[model samples]
Target: MDLMDLSHQNRINTQLSKQKVGKTIYTDCIRAENIKQIVPAITQCIECYPRFHRAENPDICIMVTGIPNVGKSSLINALRRMHLRKGKASRVGGEPGITRSVLSKIQVSENPLIYLLDTPGVLSPRIENVETGMKLALCGTILDHLVGEDIIADYLLYTLNNYPQHRYVQHYELEGPCDNIETLLKEIAKKLRKTQKVTAITGTGKFSEYPDGFLFH
Candidate 1:
């Protein structure tokens, strides 16, 4: 199963179509919490698989795997809540490497007797290009520090401007869309009040500003 943010719906669909994989189901496991679409789809898959039909119980065991910090554990928990009315069977976090090892099967359903095994996220041994690596870093699949925050921030700004996504203009109250990162950062710092006073070498206090992180909302 793959977990994705709905905001990138068009890009996700286009990429998936190029892979030639059949019968893929998309679900917004975190934001929309739409497990209602998943249960029936999973049932249909199991019904079509001949090996499951030969078994007397026909219990289903699904393995959840994806890139780091892509919400495999969150999906398991959501499914359990939807089907069994139970609390979390797995731990969740905002950063990657939260689930380091394979977890034992956790029951999510009773009637067909469904269980899901949560596994650590994996990445390809080789990345095709620099742009792909940066994209992964932006998605939180890779550690931000490894790629350097400045580069990620700059690439993000470039992408936003390339797409001409102007929400940032209104959010930060900028005069208009900007191509310069330094100018945009200053505006953001001022808007968020993230400036601090520090003593200079000449024994004079000077204010330094830093941009604070924010969600698009």
Candidate 2:
């Protein structure tokens, strides 16, 4: 089947799967404006999709990573609808870590070749440290790319020493106690610089640079 057909089938399947044994399942379809907002990002990825599809020397492997409830699944869903205009093959849910193994090599088109790796969400290995959990949560499913060695080290130290609260001192912008999305994006940018430096020297840079203003609305 074509990618569009597969996507449509996936969406239908998802709706069917959500039907409760006794309870009714109500579907609130996505709004047009929301779809419009995510189109550019999806289009940007689509342009690079074909390269990843090529058998050898793929140009880019786009990995959508982010914290739980930060709209990773929603964003992917939007991309699927806008670009593929079909349903999803994989199931999506509110519970964390639903996307457990890597989903490799989904062809957006035959010629260009684009691949997407929808990985399991990042979670705290253990619940012993709340700070560690927060950091893991912040790093999202694609922590390998979103975080760098030095930032990881600093995050580890901060978490281990119970200084996670300090992350908000100057790095984060909180209105009262709630985090501001703009602030989060700024912090991420700063962390990226530190992480890249470490990766350059250590040969561990596998993460891709995120587009500017990605974390903000």
RMSD (Å) per prediction: 5.2, 21.3
Model 1: how far residue 86 lies from native, Å: 0.8
Per-residue accuracy of model 1 over 76-144 as CA lDDT, tens digit each = 998888889899989999888899999899998887688999999999999999999999999888888
Off by over 4 Å in 2: 1-29, 37-60, 107-114, 124-217
Whole-model lDDT values for every prediction: 0.80, 0.49
Please list all clashing residue pairs in model 1, or write none if there are none: none
How displaced is residue 109 in candidate 1, in Å?
Answer: 0.7
Clashes of each: 0, 13
Model 2, range 11-80, lDDT digits (tens) per residue? 7666766883222222222665545544345446555645545556644446766455445555556556
- Model 1, position 116, has a per-residue lDDT of 91
